[model samples]
Target: MQIRDLPYADPGVADARSGPRFLLWLGRNQLGGQLKALAWGLLHFCGVAGLPLGVGRAVQAVVDRSGSALALAGALIILCGVAITLGDTMLHRTAVTNWITAAARVQQLLARKAAELGAALTRRVAAGEVVAVSTGDVEKIGWFVEALSRFAAAAITVVLVCVGLVLYVPELGVVVAVGVPVLALAVLPLLPRATRRADVQREKAGRATELASDTVAGLRVLRGIGGEELFLGRYRQASQEVRRAAVRSARMWALISAVQVLLPGLLLITVVWYGAGLAQDGRIEVGELVTVFSAVTLLMYPLRHFEEIAMAYSFSRPSAKRAARVLALRRTTEPSGVEYGRPSGDLYDPATGVLAPSGRFTAVVCGDPDAAGLLAERLGGHPAADPDGAASVLLGGVPLDELALDEARAAVLVQDKDPVLLSGTLQELLDVPSSGKVSAEDALKAAQCGDVLDALAQASVDTDGDGDGDPMRTRITERGRSLSGGQRQRLALARSLVTDPEVLVLDEPTSAVDSHTEARIAAGVKELRAGRTTVVFASSPLLLDRADRVVFVHDGDVAAVGVHRELLHGNAEYRAVVTRETEEEQLDGITAIGELAVLEEIEESA
Candidate 1:
């Protein structure tokens, strides 16, 4: 593909069965660019290889005292120079183009895969791994891809130069030929060790990156809980491990590089020493001696490409494997293209036996936070395995997995308990694909986000000139760390509300807010989402009391289902889960209050 056509309309399906296969697939896709680079490289190295011959002829012309021959030799040298200049320039251009194009294709494919998998991508792959693959791995994969064509050209040029030397002076040519191959192959024994070292370094680096990502993501929480030093120490240890691995890997590669340099130097010394002897014995001409020396010197340049190609492959192999692994992951909910226009029914998970009735507000009280999260994920078709037997989570009697992915997503929106607020302006965050019935302002109001907007505006003022006081234009820090947990929650809630999906499953949406604000938010949500299917997984009395029905989930199944008050009074488990106060504690607290009141009355009477 042309450079201008970069970011292919489709990067095409990758052969991600293995790292090597994925690399080959990338090579095949960029065949046109590779061919162009190969052609230019051939021209370039061929020019470079011809230089010694031209110089040899000039030396011979001088010794023979032939002016005509000397002029011819001069012309030949100039011709070779022209080819070298032109070919080298174009070769570099094409090589860089190939590198950039390959990198772009990988990035695009990654983006597409991320979009396809959505939240499931992180669940399957570590966040740090994903980051490393997209950033560092892309460049490594591209480096090998571009190196291939150049390496091929260099190899062919070496062969041609060797053949030319052999034909010119069979004795010296044979020696040079044999020595060159030895020099090239000597580094092979060291490659496996070097590759191993590199892989270890990469693995360690990935762990460090994951640790850093996790640490940064939870820095606010860590500070709140006064666990900053603990995480910081862990990250420091990880970083040190990465550094030590890198040093070890660097030492191994340095040894390989030294071998490559030292061996080639030895070969060059042998050629010069032997050729000088041959000239002295009158077995070869003095000019031929110069030719052999110059040719060997020039050959050293292309020989470096061999070492480079090895290094590139060593680094990129693991990178390609990581990329392949990520791309190989498939979504559990495979879209079947089943045309179920605007799914309208209860969101049911047969696995958990939890159901949120259509067009009703349902509250789920799961005692286990982990179980609640899994249930929320299942509700949104983000499970590793499709809930079979009934096919998957059914919406309106139609399995969510059976529907188109986009259709399913549009119909059901699940906001996890710890919702992420991506870095963007307030307006951009709320610019979701919505039903359009609720405006951003209305969504914000319904989510009780006035304080968040004000905080954003105040932040804007602190950063910029008196800041237009427009929260919509305020720049949020990455992951919305600039805001408090409560503010981030409110903003995320507003964003979700703007979508107005048919079925909205929210897990502890108001957990971070105070009781008064939570009560108002409960009312706001009830009023705004009236007549829509909304399932909130929370045990807050204010939120639960507002639900039309409450479903108490215990041991991954619906243990009891009724209004919040009825369940709270009738089901001891449900009451304990919600209130966290046993009947004995309640009686003791009441008795203590009555005794205090009696003492106060007697004292006043006395």
Candidate 2:
């Protein structure tokens, strides 16, 4: 396939059995590109090998004073040059095409897996590793696949060159043949050590890359906490470690390169020394000596390809393994049957024994946020990891995981606490691919995003003071960094509401907002989702009071289920978790009042 028409309809199931298997799979995937590259590579090497024969014939013709033979040899040499030019150009083009296509295929596969796994992908693989695989690892894999054709062509040429020399002059040919193999094989012993060094360098580089990525992602937070210098120092140390590892790796590879060059040069010198002795004994012709010498000199070029191929394999093996790991991961839920599931009754999690009734707001109070996140994911039928043999969440007596992915997604929308707001216009962020049941205005109102809309409108480019600004036109910075925490949260809520799923699972949706804003949002959510199944995981009294029922999740299981008032009065565990937050707010209020009184006294003294 062409580069422009990339992102194959089916990237095809990867052969993740091993690193070598994965590299072979990538090669097989781009067979057409590889074949084209191979053909050109063969042509190029043929031109390279054919040159020595033509030069020998021309020299003999000159020595014999045969004008006709000289013209023929000159024509052959020119033809080889032309072939070399065309072959080299086309070979490079095809090789690059193979590289591009192979990389694209891997990227498509990784993207598909990312979509399937969502936030789980990052959890399963470190964010740095994923980043490295997608970028550097992908390129390395493509490089190896592309290099295979050239490596093959070079190897074949070396064999052919040695065979031709044997046919032309057996005495010299035997020595050349035996010596060439020795030169090639001698460097093989040092390769394992070099590869080990390379692996160490790669590992350090990946860690450094991950650290840099994390530091950049949390740059805003670092600045707020005045910890930029601390992170920078950490990164500096990481960068230095990577540098030292790279230097060690380079030194080993340099030694390998030195050996490869020195051995081949020694072989060339030995062949010339022996061939000169043969010529002196009248055993071989002058033309034959020239041809053998030129062939040995040219042979050095192809031998270098062997060194490159080894290096390529060493680097790409780890990369392919990482890519394969990502490709092999299966979504936690396996499709059970053909039928799509829609819960007509209560949404039940058998493991936790929590029932979120249909057509009502249910607030889940999980003592641990991690546990709550896991439960929320399970409820949505998209658990990040394996659910420990627990039965799939059931809705209306239908297994959630049994439904088609689309159907399951349509049925439940779980908004995690750390929701990302993609960089785009406000309209684009809300324009999610889903059933368009909820209007933008309705969702914004329900999300209590009036203040958010105003702030966005003020930041919008088209703020002409006409008083009827379209907040949708506002451009959100990456992850909505330009907006406050509460604004970003509200915007995320609005986007979720726009989807209007069957069961809306919100985890700490209004955590960043003030108590008053949280209360308004709590009421607005209840109003907007009047007859829909809404599950809110929270500990705030404002949100819990509005819930139709409150399920207290303590120590990993459902401990109590009742209305907000009943739970507050009856369950002490529930009361403490909820009231403790409120008590802190009251204490903050008292502190503020006392500070204001002190300021008033200071003003009176002045």
Candidate 3:
């Protein structure tokens, strides 16, 4: 395919059986492109090999003092030059196109795999390895793919040139033929060592990249804990190891390069030396000797491709293996080819015996924050930390794993306690694949963040003189770090509200906001999601009171199920987990609740 028409529609399913199989699969998919490149490469190398023959013919013509023969030989040389120019140009163009297209295809596959695995990808594979596969590994794989066809053409040209030399002057041709393979295969012995060094360098580099990624991701936390220097020192040591490994790899490759040059030089010397004896013995003409020497010299050029192909394969092999390993990871809730459409029943976790009734607001109170987080993820069909022990979440009497990935994601949306906001425009952030029932403006209002819109618009106006004061146009920094914690939390809540899924599971979504805003947000959510199934895993009284039903999960199972006030009065354990109030203070809760309401009203009015 052409470069402009790149990024194949499917990229097809990858063969993740092994690294070599994956590499072969990639090659098979691009056979058409490789053939085109190979054809052009053959023309180029043949044109180059034909040049020495043209020169030898012209020299013979000059010695004969024949004007017409000399003129013909000159024209032949010009024709060879034209062929070389045309063939070389097209060959390079096709080869580069092949390289770019192969890289694009691999990248598309990686992207598809990443989308399939989501956050689970990092848990299954190292983030740095994934990064390396998409970056350095992709280029190496493409390089090998592009180099293969050219190497094939070069090898063919070498064989043809050797046969031609043997036919023209069998005496020198025998030595040249024997010596050429020796030159090509001479570097084979050092390749294992070179490849091992390269692998070490690649491993070191991946570690360094992973360390840097982790450090950057937790930079704010690192600074808060005064551990920046510790991480920095660790990163520095990793970088030094990478540098040392790279140097060792480079040295081995340099040695191979030296051998490539030296062996070819020795072959050229031998061909010239042997041909000279033949010339002096009158067994070969002066012109024939020149032709043999020139042909052997040209043969060295194509033979270099052997070493290049070896180097390319060595580097790309590990990269392909790493990529294969990542792509091979399957989610625990992955589809089983069952057709499940539009889930419409209670969301139940059989493992925890917790049921979120259909079309009702349910709040789950878990004392352990980590357990609550795991429950939220499981509710959305994502496996918890201990996936093997956790049972599949069921919706509408169907296990989530039976549904397609798209269907499962659409049926349930989970907002983790620590939701991340990617860097983009405000519009882009809210532009999720959502049910059209809820509008962005309405969702923002329900999230109780109208002030966030105003702040965004004002920020836009300040940044750009010609701003139309559109909040949607405002660009958010990475992770929304430029905004306050409350603002980021509210915006994320607003985004989730926009989705308006069949079932929404929120884990302490308002933990960053104040009690006043949290109360308003709870009311807004209750009003907006009146008829939908929403599960909020939280302990706040405001949120729990708003729920149609409250489930108190003790240890790892459901302990009690009731309304917030009923649980507070009847279950002392539930009251302690929800409000952390002593028995004496509980008697005065009515007066405290009245005071809180009065303060909320005053805050609202102000």
- Give the better candidate number (1 or 2) by lDDT: 1
CA error at residue 155 for candidate 3, angstroms: 1.2
For each candidate, what is the lDDT? 0.87, 0.85, 0.87
| Best of the candidates, TM-score | 3
In model 3, which regions exceed 4 Å deviation? Answer: 383-386, 569-576, 579-606
Candidate 2, pairs of clashing residues: 343-395, 343-396, 344-396, 345-396
Q: Kindly list the per-residue Cα lDDT of model 2 for residues 1-606, writing each as its tens digit.
A: 777787788999899888889999988888888778888988898898888888988998888899998899899899999989999999999888888888998999899888777777888888888898999999999999989988888888889888988988899899899988887888898899988988888888889888888888789899999999999999999999999998998898899889988988898899899989998898987778888988888888888889999999999988898899888888667777777545566798988888999998999998888888888888888766436778788889888777877778888888999999999988999888655878889999988899888887776635565545668877789989899999999999999988888899999999999866887788888898888899999987778878999999998789999987777666667766776635564544443344335434543542
On lDDT, the stronger of 2 and 3 is 3
| Cα RMSD of predicted structure 3 | 2.7
**Each candidate: RMSD to true structure?**
5.0, 5.4, 2.7
Which residue pairs clash in candidate 1?
A: none
Candidate 3: worst 10 consecutive residues by lDDT? 590-599
The lDDT of model 3 is: 0.87
